[model samples]
Target: MPLIEIKHEGLHKYRVIKGNDQYVVEQKARVQLQQWDEMWNKKQEAERKKIEREKAAIEKVQKKAMAEQQTQDAIDELEMIDNTLIYTLEIDDRIDWDSLKDLSDFKDPKPIAPNKPLYSSEPQKESYKPKYKLWDKILPSIKQKKIDESMKVYEEALDIWKNETEKINSKYEKEVDEFKERLKNWEEEKESFEREQKEKNDAIEKRKEQYLSGESESIIDYCDMVLSNSNYPDYFPQEFDIDYNSQNKTLIVEYILPDISDLPTLKGVKYIATKDEYKESYLSETVVKKMYDKLLYDITLRTIHELYEADAISAIDSIVFNGWVNTLNKATGKKQDICILSIQTNKEEFLEINLKLVDSKSCFKNFKGIGSSKLFSLTPIAPILKINREDSRFVDAYNVTGKVDEDTNLAAMDWQDFEHLIRELFEKEFNTSGGEVKITRASKDGGVDAVAFDPDPIRGGKIVIQAKRYTNVVGVSAVRDLYGTVMNEGATKGILVSTADFGPDAYNFAKDKPLTLLNGNNLLHLLHKHGHKAKIDLKEAKLIMKEK
Candidate 1:
């Protein structure tokens, strides 16, 4: 029935006796309590063990659930990619510049009065009047004396209250003045902001009017805004350059596309219970390639459609989209950008088709887009037309070839001298075809080291050249900048020559983009070809620079 019963005495001990055996009570009670304590300890230990087991089981289940959630997320991402074009169709591509204006009024400061001091209200004059009783009449002298004392005390109290009231009024007046100053400052700031807002709105209106009038630069700027406002997945690169031709009302867009390697590869994540680890599955190569091709096609068509739909002013009749990708070249182990697709579609033809019902790849084919059938392979193709180059930043150039010799180390030459030397050599090379090279002014080059105009119709046009005289290797950034210059200048080609050498990435980026990169060896060969020789010693150049 009961294991043990305990009795309490004073603080000295608890009588944890088991049974009433009066002869051997002490020894039998001790033994029974010892057994009972051991049994209680075992029960507590069993409870702790059960809790640990449940905790471990719950953790395992949570891990598996997390893995399942990850798998579902990956699947959702893939679905979004598959419907990229379809999703974009629902968005209104036009920009509402009015809604973007900041018209919120400034909040005015509320007037806060000072807390008034608890000053006693003016004492009533009649309350201090002395009472005249019958006994006071019998003692007229005493009563008159009392009345005089009371009047003196009342005058003294009134004087003290007047002083306290003055101090409180002074404090209240000071607080009011301080609040007035703060309000004045706030009003000044609000006025200045209102003026700025008015100017901003005026500028926006002017730009809108220019865009409506079909101004060349204004049209390009508006198109840029349209593209910037378009939403895309975070994985996509939103970098692009635009050029508009007013005569035919055509816009050319050079957009940087994300590489296939940059896309998410995990098809699903699975939790392996036996190993207690997560395993990820990936899409097959063939499936990825097919999806990549379709995506490229979707992007090509979607870009053109958006621009056409957003052209509310009817200034643009057609758009040309050239999709370019920056990636590492496996063959050369260098980074380069290749134009994977180019498509031109007019407003009339593009608006006639129901985009939601058409397959992206088939629609692109119907419009005769330029690209390889298998786009994942990163094949290069020529654009139907190039942006026109009409830069006016070029100034009258000076000559520097009269100062060069066989002993001249180009790596140690002045930067300005190096640019002129490059210009002279190119001049000699292009002279055979009646082309001339001109070096831009040193202070106003605007990212253009030199400019060359070739007279040959088939192989010649405005070519932009940049010179880099570096003791270290030229990286991909310089090469990428050259490509941007080529697009901005509207040149037929771009050339980058360095005195030291180029990094692997620089070489990679120059591929297929009408760009030329000449390393130290190539520079030496070009000089030798022109019956002149120059050394490119980077180590000596560094030493000279350090000494200077």
Candidate 2:
């Protein structure tokens, strides 16, 4: 319809179509305007949705921090409970209340008074509902005004829409900028995480090779890492220390024993619905001790088992285990770390025993490795082999500063590096042996340092090499131990290389044995014969070492 000025519905002027064809022009213009309005509204709605999603993303990141804090708090509570031994306990033997009246410390038990609840009922959850818009009434009214060309109320309505739309667009633009910043941060964080992961994997691979070739400090650090990640029962603390001796190829494990005094004796408490009270049930002290003893024994076995199962442990030929408890001695009124149990078992011997079928009480006895009789009694026992801190693998050296110069001579290189250098020298010498020779981890393993299998078909057998960096004359004791190791391992021949000359007694002992002793001169010659330059000067080595 065509607009014509006329009084209608309290308006001084209203739009009307005079003829049939004139109304078509007005309707077409109305359609075009309506399309423009609808397109703009769609654009605004799309941006509103985008803004909402970004807000949700920000909220999720905030919630993650809160969740992590909650998890850490729960773990702390469990640790405290474990240390205090407040787990459920059972009491079978009742104490007579009247008999303790004469004692100054005697007192009757009192029921605990209940305190207020931590909080009111948890926050209620409500379903979400979208807002209702009056677009039906408002849209039609605005279209009629625009079509009539009133320009007064029509322009006012447009101004309001434009202003509101602009406000929303401004808000959405700000949100988008914030979202973009967050996205950049997330990308940077991800890249950094990937870099860190790559570094960690590289370190693991390098350490794996070092560990397999008789560098076991990596194994100790690996075990600690695994245990640190392990989820122990709430309240239980896992603490341990380890060292390796390459000579006999033995791992020395010093583990902290858990306090069992607070172990729960009660099986459970039954809530009497009729009386509105709980009936406590407790186990006898003897029963509690027996349970704790079994638990302690199980823990000891599990620790050793986890280490043995690790693929990284290549050279641990045997283990010397010790569990100590830190407590105050009533008699001395001094804190002491009392070694409750100590056992030594070779890898060959330990692998033959089955843990499932063996009782914890009889495990030590069956292995013939127990050195102490008072596990539960807490009697202290001296460790047969003490940990050599100097033996710590360079790769896992913690709290160490100032890099050690790798190019330095034998006197300056640490024991692990010295052993590694020797392995490299020998590996080069036996490169044509047709098989890879591996060094056993630095541990007390009789006297074998590295093992090589010479496959000449006729001379195909195990060959052992011992690297002795001693500045003094190689003694008969070392040669004898090497010979013993060769016999124990059933090797065809053994070689012992030293940085110093062997005594007459060492040569006498090796002359009849299936062993060859290489002095400092011979070792250098062999290394040089294999296209490697190396020299051992005992006097110079001693002077350099003593400078420390």
Candidate 3:
């Protein structure tokens, strides 16, 4: 009898029993293997958990470091903004006209060649070799049968190969045609691109010529391009309107300044690893206010310097920069736009100052720029001069004062004549200080009845005038419209003149706004002061209207 041999892991054992039964031994080995497997699995699970905890700890540390880096970056950004004027001194403010052109040349797309099928040779038939054996001479018919079968199979394979080759050739022809079509489309696209590029280059050249010719509109456009190309932080509004006065070669810029609230209040961030939380610290209100004031001063001086330096064509002799802010009025709880700072300086005078060495606010004051001591207060200040927008809506005005007398009730006058009469009165009012007033087209003036161009640099600018020849009292709606028009037109002030008195709400609405509400009495006083006499008899005019 053979001896029973049992192997268990590294141990070998031979056992002799009454019967050679391996079932019991196999069962014992299986139980031992399961126990070892359980132990190994537990060990692997413990190691995996340890790795996960370590990974999580590392990720938390990385996150805390990243948060700290972001806080520092924000602080650095604020510091950069504080030195805006100084940093800009190193930059070249002039516009390189050539750089504005599309300098990238057209590149022909890579041609895709037709995928020709690989040349496949026709299948050749193999020659049949007769099998030789001792009995082959006696069995020639069997060998012949085998040779015929081989020839038939070879013929069938040759026919199949011919068909496949034909299909491949046909596909190759179609691919060639498609390639030609694609090439034609590419050619047309290239032609169109070249034409467009040529047209664009021509337009740029024309604009350059116009800008160099000292054309007022073209100069304004060039200045706008120069300003638009400037790089600023994302928080900056960077919105501005530019106007050029060719007569005086002065460029007027109405720039939108960022409010104090627009800046980042966060000073730093700290991470608590135990709590797994980040705590942020913020700048105090006093520091924020100081930053706001310094930033405004920097912007004012920086803008003036940029325009002046970029005036390579000598198109700009002087610059009038008005810094406006759009912010919520805490008192009224509504949006308000007000000019916070204004500076008018010639290029010669402004360029002489070394911006890197001087303090921003002090330099601004040295130039006699007007602003409140604390710019964060949002105090409204008058500009030295404002951009006079050329409005095509203004039509020539006829003398309405020449046709009016004391008895000529303004309330009874024609609505169109009343509008012209208001223009004449204002013309007379501003004429003493070299101001001119023009009446806009009737019904098409876009809510503007008249516009006063007052040349008084200190207090004069574009004044929007709306004339309401109402026999009844004027409501606040008209006053609100005047305010909106002033903002839309970028005017320094708005004057609402009515034949009758304004309601108390109308006056209240105009309060704290750059609006002047002239009731019947005020209108009469203005008329008398301008050496013109007119009467605003609303009650008499109402009775006369009933008769009609």
Candidate 4:
């Protein structure tokens, strides 16, 4: 029977009223659902924020402790130097002036021990004599006594000077020995420190190189390798995608969820005490729906948990999970894959969740997930736009290197690579045009680069395509040649693509005809729109061409 709304309000009211004297069921159901939603919705926002705050605080504390430990290690190594040599310069008074200057200049020091103190004689002291200059000549005995006394005073002063000089020299030599020992130890420690730091830095650099060179395979490949050997429930298709955003240090996983039909409907078997027998009964639809919703939630959480746990490198700080399903579309009566839920969660945030006790649906809502209106509905789910990946492996064509001159740029991609890239591009484009694009043989194919076979009866036939890795702006001649090739081959259309922009005449010529001209920018945009990235510089390409 076709269902239709009653045209009259009175009739509709009557129909709902006696609609089995169960008119209150729908309204009561709505009230119950509303109560359940309210129970979770009005939760204090501060409670959710506490989780983030705690994680940040813990990370901050750990980092601070690590920095402190490094600082202490360095300080301990430096403290091994002689404290007095470091704190005082007492050796300055003992060093030879000549050698002292050289030592300060970082040159070899040949300090010589002195038998006497280093002093300059400014003037001789004059002594008061009792007019004895001539008297001493007349009196030989007095003159002899005066000479002996003068010798005695001189010897006494020399003895004192020698002792002081010896002591100073002895201390200078000791200080020199101590300084050398400390310097040797310090140099050794410094070298060790630098070597250790270099080793650490080299390890990090190796990892970085592996990351960029696709050797590490990023988290996506890592998880795939791990999960491929992982044990799981039977008939569970572990179809998923892993994309790492280097900028954000995040791993986005698009997991294909199983259909609700696969979920267990019976919660548990119960005993009928009255009859003393066990009753095997199926769960109510509402209970089954709740269990299924929770199962999906559990699966999402489990996936994130597995990735985080298996990742020893912790390359990904957080994961964005997109759980998708294939549901039948009423319009086309075909099953279409669509994402039913999306969640962005950090490791700390997810590990804190207790799946067994928490209301899975409410928790999913708290974590900000988008799903279908009803958990068990047959309606199709829309995918989250941000998590979608743009397949751009084709852009790698411009990055080809090796066996080519260093002066060459993007345009220097070997002719074979250029031809392959063009074939892939036109194949994608012509696929929409109802044609199969095939590249001609490398040697000679009647001056044709490629040909597209379109099966559509109207506006569909063989389309000739030519790829020009030109550094200079393509002139009208290339466009004219493509058109001639199309006509010669009895094709329906023609396209000429170049790495450089097309000249005005070239565009104008193709504008009025069945031929199409794709310049460098147009080609790039087409590649990017279809999830490819490429780099092209006309001036650089031109310079490289000139060099070649």
How would the candidate models be sorted by TM-score, starting from the highest?
1, 3, 2, 4
Q: How far is candidate 3 from the true structure (C-alpha RMSD, Å)?
A: 17.8
Candidate 2 achieves a global lDDT of: 0.59
Specify the poorest-scoring 10-residue window by lDDT in model 3. Answer: 10-19
Residue-level lDDT tens digits of model 4 in 1-548:
22222223322221221233344555655555555455545554555788778876676566555545645553443232112122222112211213212122223343433343354332222431223588798999998888777767666666766777777778777777777777776666665555544533453344344534543233455555444444444645566656677666787787777777665443334444345444444557786676566667766766666676666665778788888777677689987776778888877787687654565567778877777657667444554435533333222233222232324344656677777777777777778855666676664443577777665545665577888888888887787667656544445588888888888877766764678888778877776666666677777766766788
Top candidate on TM-score is 1
Q: Choose the strongest candidate by lDDT.
A: 3
lDDT of 2 by residue, 228-293 (tens): 444456545466666666677678887777666645454544544445445655657676666666
Q: Which of candidates 1 and 3 is the stronger one according to lDDT? A: 3
| Poorly placed runs, candidate 4 (over 4 Å) | 1-216, 264-284, 378-385, 391-393, 396-414, 417-548
TM-score of each: 0.68, 0.39, 0.58, 0.34
How close to the true structure is residue 534 of candidate 4, measured as C-alpha lDDT? 67
Put down candidate 1 lDDT per residue, 316-397, tens digits, no spaces. 8888899999889989998787898888888898899998889888898888888888889899888887665444655565
Give stretches of model 3 more than 4 Å off: 1-38, 110-184, 392-548
Q: What is the lDDT of residue 47 in candidate 4?
A: 57
Superposition TM-score, candidate 4 onto the true structure:
0.34
**Where in model 2 is the C-alpha error above 4 Å?**
1-193, 212-214, 229-231, 273-275, 311-313, 371-374, 390-548
Error of 1 at 227 (Å): 1.4
lDDT (Cα) of model 3: 0.81
The RMSD of every model to the true structure, in order and in angstroms, is: 13.7, 32.3, 17.8, 36.2
